[model samples]
Target: MLNFKNIAIRRGNRLLFSKASFIIHKGQKIGLTGANGVGKSSFFALLRGELHSDEGEFSMPPNLEIAHVAQETPALDCTAIDYVLDGDRELRQLQQQLAAAEQAQDGLKQAELHGNLDHIGGYTAQARASRLLNGLGFSTAQEIHPVSSFSGGWRMRLNLAQALMCRSDVLLLDEPTNHLDLDAVIWLQDWLGRYPGTLLLISHDRDFLDAITDHIVHIEQNNAEIYTGNYSDFERMRAEKLSQQQSAFEKQQREIAHIQSFVDRFKAKASKAKQAQSRIKSLERMEIIAQAHVDSPFNFRFPAPKKLPNPLLKIEDADIGYGDKVVIKNASLSITPGDRIGLLGPNGAGKSSLIKVLSGQMRQLNGELHSAESLNIGYFAQHQLEQLRLDESPLWHLQKLDKQASEKDLRNFLGGFDFRGDKVNDPIGPFSGGEKARLVLALLVYQNPNLLLLDEPTNHLDLEMRHALSVALQEYEGALVVVSHDRHLLRSVTDQLLLVANGKLQVFDGDLDDYRLWLAENKKTGDEPAPAAIASPAVRKDERKLEAKRRNTLKPFMDAVKKSEALVDKLQQQQIELESKLADPSLYQEENKESLKTLLAEKSRIDNALHQAEDNWMVAEENLQQAEKSCIN
Candidate 1:
């Protein structure tokens, strides 16, 4: 058991929480939740002995084995499975001792060590490590790969696996699902449910917390309060408490207002001065109730698209993949104006490939893809965050998109995403992942695209931002197709689920719960048979020839489209500059009359040129589409 008595903690000069008292009992799974930088991680540090309370007392069982995922993984040549096995320090120590005993030819010592190994299940440690690796989305083949070979995100998964491999009395996991897919998240959820230990988890994923935790310790306003139930229950209880708080605050305000009014009316008269003084004393004696504040900082909506084509995009008998390697074969999907789709699949199942094809970021290897002329895609993927100019500000990015938009309007829009004040103008290079993700999302939302294809949109977002996004998506009129590990977001925002597996894109027959069951069954049965062998050499040769011919035929039309687009962009920029000059009040003064007239004339000329350029762009785009159709036919 862990007990805290009026604990006060500080990070530098900032007081995180004070007078925090709670008892975390054995075998209890508690979720620590709060806004970012609200001392949840600091609390974990306290448990790990990296920090000490500034006041009062905190106590835990002595020598309690606690396991936590490492934040950084050093590059190592050791195989992944071996690295995970190292989590069991006792098992490793026993093995080393037994090996030394064998080298020394100490038969008696060897026998004693073997008995101890059997008692601790050391013989099966390797198999246990492998299971942890597999459950965290690693393939049997990847288990042999060196730790140094894995990417950063995969390394994080390995760290998680290693932490789970430990047979500890207590476990601490923070944002365990951030780097995982839905299938792996489900697997970890099940694993944690079966873990015979006290678990303290810090996660922004509400569904994960609900599935794994029995109690919630919420930190807010420099206070930590333990609730009796899961995340949903805590939300309900908090809402009710806040409501009562609001009522009391309102009642207090009314009483104060009444007393103030009486004092103002009576204080001027000599006879009523004493009564007014008594009223003032009563007002001073009354305690002020703080107003309830439970509002999310994020509150933005997708602007309505300029045009809503019925079928925004369509794919028929398409094969999506890199050159000669097919990831998704014979895929057929139609996205209309209001389709809400959530994609589900195991890691590396080509869900992202399909999204890329739909977004026109990748060309189909075979078959037809027809996009409406009015289709405006607001595609968001994790990589796009990296594409943002780190040296620039959020306002700069928005102004680049629409220089004609007023600064006030742009700032107001950014404020909805919580990028207000000087923060909007600050360089984003030093921003955290969540801030970068919010900026990416803010840019996407400002585009007013008819189709939204998001790949793991909630990866770095907090609970408040996630809730705000879910609410905004609910009110969105555009078609949304998202691939996210967040089950709560999926359940709230998507009406249909699509399963991507076995090189096929098909509508899932059931919801997320059914999908979870399917994953378990599929694991038992093994992966769907490997995608059918590649086409014959002669057939491949012919397909390559056809692809080359199509590319050759579309080159001129594509070039024309690009040229027209550039011209339109150039003209719009010029127009924006001219309009900006015209907007200055100083330019309208007598001394600047001639300059204003010239600016207005230039603006008129640029507007005409921009209109012509826009028309040319449409013509070129139409020609390109027709050429593509011809090639398809």
Candidate 2:
């Protein structure tokens, strides 16, 4: 058990927590919730002794061992496994001590050493480490990879895994899922739900915290209060509290107003003056209920377009995907002006590939794809960094985009994307993934393209950022094509859906979730049901026409898919040529080094083209497979 008594914490001169107290017993999972900048992380740090409260007594079971995995990892350079293995410091030390003793004048010491090992449970360290690695999505092979070779997100995972391996009595985690993909996040949720130790997780992921935690401790207005139950439960409880507060406030307002009316009417009279004055004094002395900013502000707005699209892009029997693996085969899809199409599916569902095909950076096989005249596309690259130089500062980035653009413009634009004053000059190399994602969006917005092509736009943003982007995208008027798995984001910003399922591009006449559910119902194997009646009346007239189009375009489409496959083959050959040149270090050692530079440049270009081709190929394959699946096996 742990108890925080009269705990007070301040940020600079601002008091974050003043004389707050809370208690946690073993086997409890607590969620910390508040608005952004409510000092949730600070409170967690205080419990871990990472930060000292100005006035407080935090008492735990005496000398209790605690481990804190911060939201952002500390800089560490070592193999993933070695770092985890270091968690068993005591066990390693004991084993080394036993080995030294055995060498120091006695063979019988080996027998005695086993007893020491048993006492420390030294036999389980390796097993424990191995389990942790696998649980955290690391294999024996990954464990051996240099930590420096990993990205910042992966490094953070390693740090988290290390903390878990230490078997701390109490665990404090801040935004544990910030670096994790959805699958990894769910896995962590399950593990933490069953964890035996005292757990405190600070996060804004409502579903994540609600599913795993049993208690919610909220920090609001420099004060702390513990509520029994999950985040969802706390929300319900908090609502009730606020409602009650509102009632009291309303009652007080009525009482005060009634008194004021009486006072106003009777102040000039002699007898009633004393009573009205006393009422006024009572009203003045009463402390008002604090107006908590409990309601999250989701006032998202989309910018209305200056003009609508006449027609954005046209595709007829287009085969789009990566080199050799076509994803959308024999698919004819069109984008009109003012169409907000949500592209959605599972991870690796080829949504991004389809966007690339529409963008014209990629050519479709067996089909003539064309964009309308004077098309302006704002593409948010899924991999990002297409426009970013790792070595360049944010200001340098702006300069590269527009030489004539001033520093003031750069700061304002970057600031709009959540990058601030000094951060606008910071090197892109050290920026967080979320920061980079926002930067990409910022760049796109500044360009003011009529056609906005966003691929997984909400990947790294926090909830606040996600809401902000969703609001902005909602108001964007030009043809908007988005690829995302965020249901909330998709639901808010899009009404039409272009679903790339299996190998076919489906123009769903409804929203994303509806499309998903429709697919599940219709596409389930061995349970073919009659087609559901169409609820969306917009596409009713085109149902048969669309079916005919799907049928008529398929043959030429398949041919186009084949041609796209051929393109992938050519790109692969180009990759092979580049790889062969890169393999020879002697090529660079020679005189001009011009050939080497050219090869490197060629390789980079080919690699990018190949990536696009591969995406196209996927669509083709998916289309082919879907066609085959629609028929008998």
Candidate 3:
């Protein structure tokens, strides 16, 4: 168990939270949450022994194994799986010792070490690491690549995979889902639910926290308090506590009434069947959760668009991707003034590519894309954060958008996003990601665009800011297309779900829960196929027969593909184990010359087998793809 007795934490002279008293018992999953800069990371540092409390005492079991995702991943030549396997320090140590014993020709020592390895399940370590990689959205082909070959975001996933590989007593995860896609986030959520250890997670994703954590430690007003149950429960308890304050009660009532008004206005509209139902549900939730955010520093909304175009943009039989390489084929979509769409698919399935196409950041390779002359697009993506003029203040950024607007007006607008006082004039060069994201959002909201394209807009936002964004989106009059792993935001804001998978774009006739079930079924089939779009009555009979025939003809190819994949996986595991043994310096010693030769010979044979297995897998995959294409044609 871990205990914090009246703990006070300070960063420089700023006291983030004091008088934090809590006991995190073993095997309990705890969520650490607060506004950005409220020292949640500092709390994690304290747990990892990188920082000490300014006052009071903190205690934990001695020799406790703590695992955390590394902030940086070094560019190394080691294979990704090997990098993950390095997380199991004990297993690595045992392998090293066993190697030394083998070199010494000490049969007894070798036997004992082998027994220890088996006891700790070291023999299956590679398979375990592969599962972690696969679950995190790394393909089998990518797993064999060197670490240096990956981009920064992929490397962060490697770091997360490494952290998860450790069989530690306590796990500390800070925004583990930030670098993940929705599918990967769901996978990680399930994985954490099964983790047999104490988990301290700091995440801004409400649904993620609600799903994984049983307790919440919330920091506010220089105080840290623990609440039993998940994040939703914490919100309820905190709302009740805050309601006791008259000012908070007034704010809460206003917020509830505001949402109630929206509900009442739309609840009777037949045209808003889905959206009205969603808002009604949100209204019910706001009654319980609104008071919890009464003191939130953020409160902003998107201004009404200058023009409400019937169809802001339209795509007809379009192909979107980098030049000459189509990622999404024959896609068709129409965005009107009030369409709210959420894109869902596996990672690398071109959701962002489609967003880029719609935003005109990239041109569609084929077909027609029509946009109304009045269509003003407000596009938000992670890359846009870098596009912000770092040396400029929020006021300056806003001024660039509306040079005619007065300083006082711009300042008031910025204040809604929590940029007040000197912060409006201060250079944003040193601002946190969350602050920068808010500034970007502020700039976007100021434009009053008729179309909003948001790709993971909540990436760096905190719970309060996310809540604010969600509420603001509900009031937005423009069309919105969002790609986010935050299910709560998606549920709150998006009325339509679009599936981008298997090189196709189609409507998903289900909610997030249905998407979760679809993902499970897709995984079971080892194919990232999206649900078939609803067929017209005229074509349904023919399509059903064709689909059945396609399945029958594709079965042999799919079976062969799965078989080759299994073979490749088995050989890869063997290769990884052999490589681990070969990495020992003692293996090169002259005294163990014969043993080294035998190991080298075994390595050569395994390498040959692995290469053949990989070639066969490639052939099988090619055959499957060809068959799929043929069937489609």
Candidate 4:
């Protein structure tokens, strides 16, 4: 167990926490939460022994193995799986020792080392690492890819995979789901739930916290308090406390006022002097209850558009992609005023590409895009944050949008986003990602566009800001198309779900929960985009005739493939049962000779059947592959 006893922690001269005591028992999954700068990360640092408490004690087992995701991944030529395998230092050491022992002709030592390797699952380490990679959304083909080949966000996932690869006693994850897509996030939530170690997670995603954590350690007002339930529970508990606090504060004010009135009226009279003195003494001894303040820093909203246009933007038979490459083809969509559409799909399935097409950032390779005569678009993408004028202040940025607006008015608007005083006029170069996001949102809102295209808008936003954005978006009069990993934001703001997959745009029939089920089913079948049946309008008749002919020709081969898959699955299950029986040591006892023989015979028979089944499946798969190739040709 980890214990913090009357601990006071300080960063620089600021006392972040004083007399904070909390016990994190073994195997307890706790979600650490607070506002952006309330020292949640510092508490993690303290746990890692990188920082000591300013006073009091912080204690845990000295031999405990703690694992955490690396903040930065160094670019290397190593394979991703090998990078993950490196997380198991003991396994690497054992392998190295065994190799050296074999080279030295130390037969006894080599045998001992091999036994140790088996004991530690060294042989299956690569398979375990591969599973971790697969669960994190890396394909089998990408597992062997060089670490440096992946983007920054992918590298962060790799780091998280590496951290999880360790055999740890305690795990510390800070915003582990920030870079992940919805599917990956779900996979990770399941994985962490099954972990056998103590977990301390720091995330702004409330849905994620609610799913994995059983306890919440909330840091607020320079104090860390432990709540006995998940994030939702903590919110409920805090809300009740705040409500009671408000009531108590009002009653206290009335009591103090009444006491003062009595003291003023009777202090000059001898008969009431003692009573007034007693009231004054009681007032001095009483504790003042402060009122609850739960105001969100964000108060801005999407102002009404200048012109309401029906069908604000339309894409007809569009193919969206980068130059010379098609990511999504045969796509079509219509955005009308007040339409709230949320795009959902697996990572790299062109959600962002479709957004770009709608926003007119990318020119379609084919078909046409139609926009209303009075169309106004406000687009927000992650890359657009880099496009901001770093040297300009928030006030200056807003002034550039409307030069006639007064500085006081601009400042007041910026204050709604928590950019007050000098922050409004200072260069935004030093601003954090969240601040930059807020500024971009502010700019987007100020534009009063009739159409909004947002991609991962809540990436760096806090829960309060996300809540504010959701509330604002719900009241927005303009059309919206948002692609986000935040499920709460998606569920709260969007009314329609559009699936961007298989190079086609289609309306999803169900909600976010259904989308998760769809993801699981697709992943089980190794179906990435579900193979779009795309054809141009000009070739519709011809394409239908060709498709019918191809289907007729491929039916037999497809049937054969399905039959073989079923046979393989059945044989595999029988083999697993046979193996389970053979694993029983009692079958080899003196009185069980007949049973032993029977089990061994059955195991051998099942093994032969499995081999034959696999062979047939391979042959059938080869025939299908050839048929597909011929049909394509």
Q: Which one wins on TM-score?
A: 3
* lDDT of candidate 4 at residue 584, scale 0 to 100: 56
lDDT of 3 by residue, 1-633 (tens): 999999999989999999888899999999999998888999999999999999999999899999999999999999998999999999999999988997997754665675577668786687699889989998766777999999999999999999999999999999999999999999999999999999999999998999999999998889999999999999999998999999989998999898777666655652543443654675568777788899988889888888897888999998887866667889999888888899999887799999998998988889999999998999999999999998889999898889999999989999999999999999999999999999999998888888999999999999999999988998888899999999989887777888997777898777787789889998888544546456687676775676677788899999998898898779767866766676566776689878877876786798699778767876786787677656543
- Best-performing candidate as measured by lDDT: 3
Query: What local lDDT does model 1 show for residue 220?
Result: 91
RMSD of 3: 4.7
Give the whole-model CA lDDT for all candidates, comma-separated: 0.81, 0.64, 0.87, 0.78
TM-score of each prediction:
0.76, 0.56, 0.90, 0.79
lDDT of 3: 0.87
- For every candidate in turn, the CA RMSD to the true structure comes to 28.1, 19.5, 4.7, 13.3
Each model's backbone clash number: 0, 36, 0, 0
Error of 4 at 44 (Å): 1.2
Please give, for residues 300-360, the per-residue lDDT of candidate 1 as tens digits: 8887888998899999999988887776789988999778788988788789999999998
TM-score of 4: 0.79
TM-score sort, best first: 3, 4, 1, 2
What is the lDDT, from 0 to 100, of the residue 619 in candidate 2? 71
The window of 10 residues in a row where model 3 has the poorest summed lDDT is: 270-279
Model 4: which residue pairs collide?
Answer: none
Model 1 lDDT at residue 365 = 93
- lDDT ranking, best first: 3, 1, 4, 2
- Candidate 4 lDDT over 558-628, as tens digits, reads 78878987986686667555555554556556788787667657756876887687667657766765675
